[model samples]
Target: MKLDVLALSGVFDTGLATVLDTLATANELAAAQGWRTQPFDVRVVGLRRRVRTALGLQVPVQPAEVANGAVADWLVLPAIGAKMPPGLIDALATREVREAAAHLRERHAAGTHIAAPCIGGFVLAESGLLDGHDATVSWWLGPLFRERYPKVRLDESRMLVASGAFVTTGAAIAHLDLALWLVRQVSPELAAVTARYLVVDTRPSQAPYVIPDHLAHSDPLVARFELWARQRLAEGFSLDVAASALATSPRTLQRRIEAVLGRSPLGYVQDLRVERAVHLLRTSRVDVEVIAAEVGYANAVTLRALLRRKLGRGVRELRARG
Candidate 1:
């Protein structure tokens, strides 16, 4: 499959470099695997007919205006800077750019997978590809994006979020995650081989943390459950209750919990509750029994056992440290 890595001018230096490096690694892997790797065809298309790097390197590109009917197997937009290029900005403000974005969106909707890193989400969002879709961008730009594009859901915690054909990364070096994910999607064996070639030791998986701040509100059901649980910690919070509120049975809810979070409903809830209790114990003046009840534990004994199992710290030790 031919993959097109389209690099835009004024793209973030760090994010762009990471994406290019990963793509190069993938290309190398594809060549080694005897897959037909198209070099010139894996293009860097210009939005306004000319592309210039922030460091003054000029890149001549086949403008997007002429790319209609292009059979692109994969479309990638690397991370862009917060500020856009003048020519590109003007193009985006024009009818042609709007139409081009629309065409790209249609192709994407028809099952052409797309990957955008960091601020490149702006491009996808402009194409209306991200409407009502959960995604992550750099943490610093989250508020500005929310202010500008009220329709697109912004997540800041996750390294990346896959919504249909579109995949987006957050700030920092999330390009690594984006590239790795694309490699896996295109060819798992190729991705693994590439990872080994690059000496990269790890892969992106859901980190064990309460809320995972980047994706805290990615899922409405989980977001609402978290909000409700926070406010009603003392009100006999249970998986059944949460499932009922979401209009799903416990079994269905458990399945979703495993699918999204890789954990059972009760297990996830208990972890959240333990996280809360640990925070309360360390930060609050509340006594153990009250804090236990506040976090939905029935009694000190059960709470202690849970703390030992989950927190790995006795309640007394946790409280004493603070």
Candidate 2:
């Protein structure tokens, strides 16, 4: 398939890198599978002929000269930074970007795929492309994103989310997951190979996913500490340790957790540990002792107790179904 991508210059560096790199990986994998791949005709479209990075580096693109081009089968805007300049906003309002968005939307209406990663979702959302769709964005922007576009169902916890022909990703590296998903949609072997090449796990679904809404708003310290704790759950987790990570008292962390999720910090952590334990039991044939150690329980008895408490079943019973 001929995939043409629209990338904006001067967007968030990390977001841009994730989109471009992932697309490159997908294209490489597709070729190995005998799926003819077209070079991405990337047009760095902006208000000016020269695009400059936030760091003062400048790049030259084909003169905003091609005003009339064929609409692509796929349109991707990786990120547009946090805010558009007044002049750029005026240009957008006057229908420059709107025209491009409309062209993509028309193709999408005809079954083409459209995608946005991180802040680029804002551009699509503004053009009414995301109305009545489930989408995602950088977690830091969730509150403002929700306030700006209430029509879009925002699920920030998912690495990536797709609605119909429109695929959206939350935060940075999630863009890679979205690309792998698209590669899988087009060809599963290509997706698997590409994942191997990139050393990333294969995310094989194009449909939206259900995950904890972790990226939604939380007190700053609470969010950071929770994420840190999640990553370390295999070692062990504690409210006191999490509070120390936040440079705050355990009571403060407890209060913040209650304010944000209506649960104590430890309770939330326990939920995550139990959730992982359940997933391990269901998906892997590993022994319960290993699963216990993998999910922060120091002993099989602790794991068994948690399994019964959280799932009302023993680990063995949960595994029996699979």
Candidate 3:
């Protein structure tokens, strides 16, 4: 498979290295294992001939203008160095990002499959190709992404999401997951072998790692609701009561929460419950039943199901990690 890895100035060092290393390993393992999978022909392409990573490491790249009219089968975009909303917004308005977005739009028009991980999704969204597609971004940037690209269906909870020809992954480290997914497209066996060699485990959801409080603080109303929700966790959630406390109608409260957090009020409440339960399980040696009750669950069974659904792990795993 022919692949072009887009290298932007101030790109995330780990994100770029992860994609390059994973694909290189896949190629090596496929050949060494005598597998019949097609080898990945990867090249680092950039708008300029010389690009520097976030940590000031010089990256040698082939200028996109001199690609000799070659169209790659896939174009992989790693996250940029901008780690926060303000910095990311500033970076997006620069000439480099605008040019890259234009170049990406042209590539997509020419039938190149695009994969973006972490804040790379911001660039892809800027290109407008993901406007009507389902995609995922770094969980912490969920609110900003939603505000900037309202047309795109953003699901920050998932580790990876594929829609049409675009595949987006959550967080910086998910670059590895994106690379493995590409290898799987060629040969699932080869992908598995590559993963095992790299000692990388599959992470299906970003929900387990997301900090709800951080996202909630993005909007004042959401922040207030979060505080109220925490106080009511052990007492059970009542939307009407919550709205009354916040001096708003239930419908208005639901709208505000959904617009800010991309989930209903009750959904956010459940997230708070899960967060509390996890904390209790890790910090204290409390029984599952007691913890569940503290988190507003009626019984241990309900909490167990919730933990497995949200975290993809049982109480035992959480305790062991604790």
Winner by TM-score = 3
> Candidate 1, which ten residues in sequence have the lowest lDDT sum?
205-214
Candidate 3: misplaced stretches above 4 Å?
Answer: 35-38
lDDT of each: 0.66, 0.65, 0.93
What lDDT tens digits, residue by residue, belong to model 2 across residues 1-322?
4454454555566655665676676776566667664334454544456665545566454433233655555666666554433433443454545655665566577566788876678778876878999987765556556656778887554557878878888765666776677667767776778788888874333212223334323357656866787798887666787777778898988876655544567776776777677788889888888988888878889989876755556776888876
Give the top-scoring candidate (lDDT): 3
Better of 1 and 2 by lDDT: 1
- Clash numbers, per candidate: 2, 0, 0
The runs of at least 3 residues in candidate 2 whose Cα sits more than 4 Å from the true structure, single-residue gaps closed, are 29-47, 59-69, 83-112, 202-322
After TM-score superposition, the amount by which residue 315's alpha carbon in candidate 2 deviates from its true location, in angstroms, is 11
Please give the ranking of all candidate structures by TM-score, highest first, separated by commas: 3, 1, 2
Predicted candidate 3 versus true structure: per-residue lDDT over 1-322, tens digit per residue: 9999999999999999999999999998888988666489898999977899999999999877527787799999999999999999999999999999999999998889999999999999999999999999999999999999999999999999999999999998999999999999988998999999999897999998999999999999899999989987988688999999999999999998888789999999999999999999989999999998898988999999999998899999998888
